[model samples]
Target chain A: MRSRGAGTRTQLTKLEELLRELRVEEVMTRRLVSVSGDFTMAQVKELLRKHRISGVPVLEGEALVGVVSIEDVTRALEQGEMGAKVRDRMSREVITVFADEPAVEAVKRFAHTKVGRLPVLDRGGKVVGILTPGDPVGRAFRVMDLRYREQEQQRWQQKGLGLEDLLGEGASLVLRFRVQGEDFAGAGKASVQAKRVLGRLGLDPGAVRRATIAAYEAEMNLIIHTRGGELTLEATPHSVVVEAVDKGPGIVDVEQALQPGFSTAPEWVCEMGFGAGMGLNNIQSCADEFEIESEVGRGTRVRAVVHLSQSGRKDRLNR
Target chain B: MRLQDIKVQLEAEQVAGSPRPELEIKEACAADLMSDVLASARPGSLLLTGLTHPQAVRVAALASLAAVVFVQGKEPLRDTLVAAEESGLPLFVTQLSLFESCGRLYQAGLRG
Candidate 1:
């Protein structure tokens, strides 16, 4: 990625537009701190405390070796695991995001891939910066943007830009929102609330439907994973759009994450009422169009589109 | 027979519904989880269960369930029955257990 120090200024497109405007050369954290895969568990544990970071990127020469987080170290500690090295605990598979791409692509990547943090790379494919969902602004923007997007959709429907106007014509809308990751009890709350608002306003059932499904998944991602993120709902008279973004850990694998019954959540996530492993698959099953992007140390974003004119019946109420 | 008749037959009470003293009884099925009901409950089917919650009625509406009988002396709170009333789905609270509810209905000529 170019350095964030030298990038063109553009109109704020919410967080997503800013990402699109980003070139890999810009915004990459140049300072590099990492550990080798050969570092022992004992060494890694000491390094974690010394670095004051939750995890460290693993490097084999100039290549990404793996990521050794405190979580892994803790697991090892619990088992009294020693002798083995960072490679043993480090997550070998990584999710990477290109520096030249827009940030909006991170949502689907996270939800569908289920990895935390994405590694941004330059044109030559060298690691540049990290996108962790833990960033303060990143978390705040995710929550606020999701709220604003839901509210914006409500506003648009109020102005009579709902089904009656769009079913037969061409119209579009963009929404911004964030999914609060910390509230497990509030899973699917946004969908229920949005459903009520749409019902009261007499909005298009289709638009409300797509939004509700999208909202449920987006909300669940934050709740189950506890990684704050953003969700946007955009609508055209002929279609609807949803984008869920998370700066949390990037997904490990897009394909595997989207598969039904494939969950990386521990028993606690299930016991605490967090995961059914249905989040990513459900989103894909509902959206007419889907796209995802992620990096190992950075974050992930998802974009989904549904064409209104050609969109078939997605009767979510019956779902 | 009318739902009101079945309620009286089983000594059931109206917790939140309008009692639909006039609504008709059709068929019967029993399940507890919402997901199961969504996948298997049929239209116009009279549902028997011990589950109580808003989501129960929500799934009922989605599946077009005709009536719900809370068996084993189970009953929904005041607000839940009101939602059922608003949706126009007949709801009954029975003292009989789930199995007994099914048995009595079957003996009484309720099919399916």
Candidate 2:
């Protein structure tokens, strides 16, 4: 199925044309998770754990001085180095790539060094962004999706087919499936359908994976906890949204259920290897945007959106 | 280290899912506790555990782990294998104990 009505298709085509000239500055994460060199081990550990990141750059003034990673922290904790400063434990000889460099260069460095992230530097050699192993690939897939969509649009135009004619009269594809309570056999159907729709739309595989996982988790939650539910999958040119609406017995405590390892699921759900209480947490982590609302006797609603774009930065020229 | 190289270093065998030998193993977390894994596991890192259940695969999928290495020669059940396959999370089995497996990966520079 194919249709373009949101005008994101136009933006995507422009992105595709710009992709060939892509640079690290355009795709790198500008909001860097960096620490001061004078930060204590306790402080650094807290930062890393809070962000759920493996490593962080150490900055002394505007200069990129070092990197403190999980390995360094683990080694420090093991050897009673917990009280020392980050400068004392960080790898001083840091490897960095310039933001003006090509994205492929960053990919090669990540692949060769096996490093989880690299601090991106500006012309002044200051850390301006951080590039992870996934960033380049994410950008690449977004470019590919845009290119494919552009080509599909051109083909349809040449064939003189209207957008509705191509996608069965819709700006977005909506997939709805009824989820039966305790229906373990049918749990993943909605998720699978959502994934297929995303893939057919030529979204980035990582985005598809994340959306599929979130949808699967939400589907499982409805199947296990509620009496019955409806799973809705909505796919757009720029994003995919999945909403799981279930009939009561709504959650007594939504926040507690979002906590990892806090499950109210029965023994059978546990036996199936789910109900770890990680479902909601995982869904939130996987989604670019996530929300859950529940009332005691009313139903629960989970809505998650995974974007098909890279970096979520719409400004191409200024940045 | 690459996952295939890690497999070879540990003399492990691929039991289920896609064998992405070329995929890099940036960091690793060795644990049997799901809570710890969820709390500490970095995305694209390797997970070395003794837990051989479907939960293990589910955890790997949720955490976006690069791969799972089962220690102590244990094997995951059929349901776990199916989950791993469905999630596209690579699974490997090693005869070495959890401590030994972690030590080897650590010696080779796998964090934790």
Candidate 3:
């Protein structure tokens, strides 16, 4: 967990550093789909449709003179001016961004001008590339991902410590809470504390979120089902480990409990906006590694581990 | 346009951040529901809504909106105003209805 947390933090720092250092020329599309001034409005409209773009720069020789957008084309078509030349339909008073400018400057231009795209110009005032809002969004994601992988490689070099070695060290943080059965008020207290501690540690947001979700669901399960239980959270620089041990009413079918919509919770618990049978399933999904052991008559113990690394996939939409 | 321009055009009362009237506003979005604004409103766009609560201010900060305008003569609670001041988000209250406020902004060259 220590390596994972450190690795994620280093990657995030790198991303911010890269964003500050990046310039528009690093991400702007160089192969521009520009139209000449002599092109007819119908041909320009066809060009936009073929490229599936909202706008394009109008170039005379190597110099960009104006930009024709979907809005401009729509206005021309509405007025039965499809046969007009591109120069007439295009906005000559165009706002452009220099390729050497910081990428952040383009963001400001997009916001202030309310323009969908900007023609990127070189030092010679030549239209070298085109920039759109999608360029920045895509570039940020790509750079972050690449940096994450690079940090992961570095982590692999210093991977001697096991989970126990990191969690049992003098620098380890362990938090324990007694979760009383039927104590709805105190059910999520431990999870909230864990979230705060992890936040203070500056763990990756995705890891912190997963750890909190796992802790809360496990805590709720202890409160709503068991007699009483102890929830323990151990956080190191690289990982968060949660252990929940209860007294009795152990699960009879661990596989069934792991399935979605499988709950032993009562009606009142359901009415309280919980016990949708997703607790165990959610815990399993949130944790990188999950384990459960139960003796039908005696007790149950569940352990979950969330690695504070950038390898976690962000596919919340599919779920 | 600037916040001061919007204030004059819509006849809005400055609830907070009145001294920073030179703040630039490029686009405007009108929605009463906070969820809609969160999902649809772009960063730096002006938010025009009648809901004056702490959550509205929170949503504006989270979305990085330029400012919040309370339409239909709506006024925010004291706590909400305090939250706005703390967040450094400008707030205004206009007597005009949502439709009238949006129409005036559109006529003034503000996009959706």
Over the stretch B1-112, how does candidate 1's per-residue lDDT look in tens digits?
A: 7776677667775554322466676776787744345445556677777776654664565455777878887657655565564555556678898888888778888877
- Of candidates 3 and 1, the better by lDDT: 3
DockQ winner, 1 or 2: 2
DockQ of all candidates, in order? Answer: 0.02, 0.03, 0.02
* Residues A251-281, model 3: lDDT tens digits: 8988888887777788977655566777777
Error of 3 at B98 (Å): 21
True contacts kept of 3: 0.00
Q: Each model's TM-score?
A: 0.43, 0.51, 0.38
Cα lDDT of model 2 by residue, A1-319, tens digit = 2455546787655555554467776567654789997898888889999988889999988888899999999998999888999988999877788988877788778878888789999898878888888877675555455556547734543554332343664487788889999887556667765665555454555666677777888888888898889998777656779899987989898878877679888997776556778878878887889998999898999999977655322212100
Interface RMSD of 3: 13.4
Worst 10 residues of 1 chain B by lDDT: B13-22
Interface RMSD of each: 15.1, 11.0, 13.4
N/CA/C clash count, model 1:
61
Error of 1 at B74 (Å): 6.3
Q: What proportion of true contacts does candidate 1 retain?
A: 0.00
lDDT of 3 at A112: 93
